[model samples]
Target: MMLIKRIAVALALWFTAGMTPLKAETTLLFNVFVPRSNNFHEVTAQWAEEVKAATNGEVTIQFTAGNMAPPPEQLEAVKSGVFDIAFIANIFLKNKAPLLQATMLPWLVDKSENASIALWRVYKKHIEPKAPFPDAHLLTLFHWEGGQLASITDTKINDIKELKSRKMWALPGPPADLLKTLGMSPVATPAVQVGEMVSRKIVSGYMGIAPEIARDFKAGPYTKTITWFPRSVTSTSFSVFMNQEKWNTLSDKNKEAIMSVSGEHFAAMAGAASNKEMQAALDEMKKNGVEIVPANPDFYKKMQAAAQPQFDAMRKEGERLGVNVDAMLEDFIKESESIK
Candidate 1:
């Protein structure tokens, strides 16, 4: 009788377990090429926390191990589903976001905030319609703006003419183009090569976002002068993308939870985060007695005129990309001025 009772109890327990639903969960992998301390990594970590909370722990974002994936491999990793998500520095994928390059036109706006906002507006209206990324879902777009010229010499970069014939390490695409147009010898080198190239005196300096001084290249000590341009040269754009297959597998609720932290909403957050880094860098530059040059209103106006060729070049490219480049530029200028 006792054996019969045990068998009956086991059967009931097994049946109940089979009837009950298992809790649903999803996990995704994120790959970052830069150091763990990069600003975007911080934002991504924050985003992971918030998204998990929003999803009530149903979704977990796992970052790739090790602090090293080449940036060039990032987008492909996600596309191949080796990683679920990644940050694609758009410059590396030339003509991949062709219309998006309009934001790189030199002397676009004085503030990073205005430039990003204007670009986001233009992107949604014109560029995004191009289906820029067919292989992935673009979660959000951000750019490092207010690019400053950091040189080895202890002199302010007060005149555009001063850069003429000087070797400048430049990212490919619009920056290299702008540097060439500005009459600087633009050397296309990887970010990791910047400091070595500088040490060899192959390039006098580089124009990049300020955090790179302390972070990427440890360039601050090597830099004797830092010049903050007004109506700044183009910002380098980056995209946070998810593998479309993985994105498609997500429920609407899960997708909402993730995307809630991106797009225009996230653009504002990214721009603010970048400004904090720039301010910290500026403070250090002051402490180190680096020559700091702020844009002269008179000089900026003259530089804007000099930037006309860059504008024209990007406009022609935009038209070829199937965007109404002239109208888009007008709208972007209007949006930027409003923000200013």
Candidate 2:
């Protein structure tokens, strides 16, 4: 009878052990450019939700948005592990990532979706694990869509010549560089300050997509015309980077699951969201009486001609770094044309 009791007790312990749940939890802090309801917000949230559900609640994300911290500081903050994830512009991080500047060169890409996909393909295939972003794992890299010109001070700027020497609120980084090339004096300012700057007559115009102007900046009182310059397309390549330590700690299965939905796949979703927002914002702008101007054929040709030298110079820089920039750019353009 003792022997029987011993066996029964052992079986009961085994059953209890088998029935116990194994809990795996990971927490991520994500940051973005605007509030929770914005286009970018929707894209990031969707990605987080999909990952969480796929992992059966094993992963959780906490998000913070707005220019709460300066844009340029985001990558370094993530590299230092202050935040597990951040959405940062390729241009803002240009100091750390010079090659990335090649992708952002003026008029190099025709569509945000194409540029985003091509850039992600190139980064995954070549960059990322090499140096600058070695401390973090790239989640996604996408570009914003359809940047246009809008003004609060002056009503109209008919041609590129008219844009020359106009005081405009620059979006900083490459846009500043692009505007300067067009002979416009860029008044360096943060996106949040655009409304106040316009109201105070500090800037004659603002350069950005309509959604940013209408939704984020609430651009109305200080503005009049929305010029459809489409000058130097303002698609920002953004990434949701995971701290390297955290990424390494994850199970291979979990990592694969996360990656399955990230990188190029994530970029597509983000690109689509940005495009939708741009369209919606333009529609909203029209309703609000903002004038939309299109670039004349001559203006388009001139802008393209001006940007070619910049592109060639970047290719030379790539060769010095031992990267085939011509191949990269060719691949980018080829794939861009193939995408749609």
TM, every model: 0.85, 0.83
Q: Stretches of candidate 2 above 4 Å error?
A: 1-23, 31-33, 62-70, 126-132, 152-155, 182-184, 208-211, 220-223, 229-232
> How accurate locally, in lDDT, is each candidate?
0.72, 0.71
lDDT of 1 by residue, 1-340 (tens): 9999999999999999889676589898888787767687787888888778888888889898864357777777888878888887777666566666666667665555665667777878987786466578988876675565667765556677666646677655555666666666688765666777777788777765454443457666677876677555667767788999988988999889887767766666676677677777777767877777787676667656766776777677776777788798789789878973
State the lDDT at 306 in candidate 2.
Answer: 54
Clashing pairs in 2: 152-223
Query: What does the lDDT come to for candidate 1?
Result: 0.72
Model 2 has how many clashing residue pairs?
Answer: 1
For TM-score, the strongest prediction is 1
Q: What is the lDDT of residue 69 in candidate 1?
A: 59
Predicted structure with the largest lDDT when compared to the true one: 1
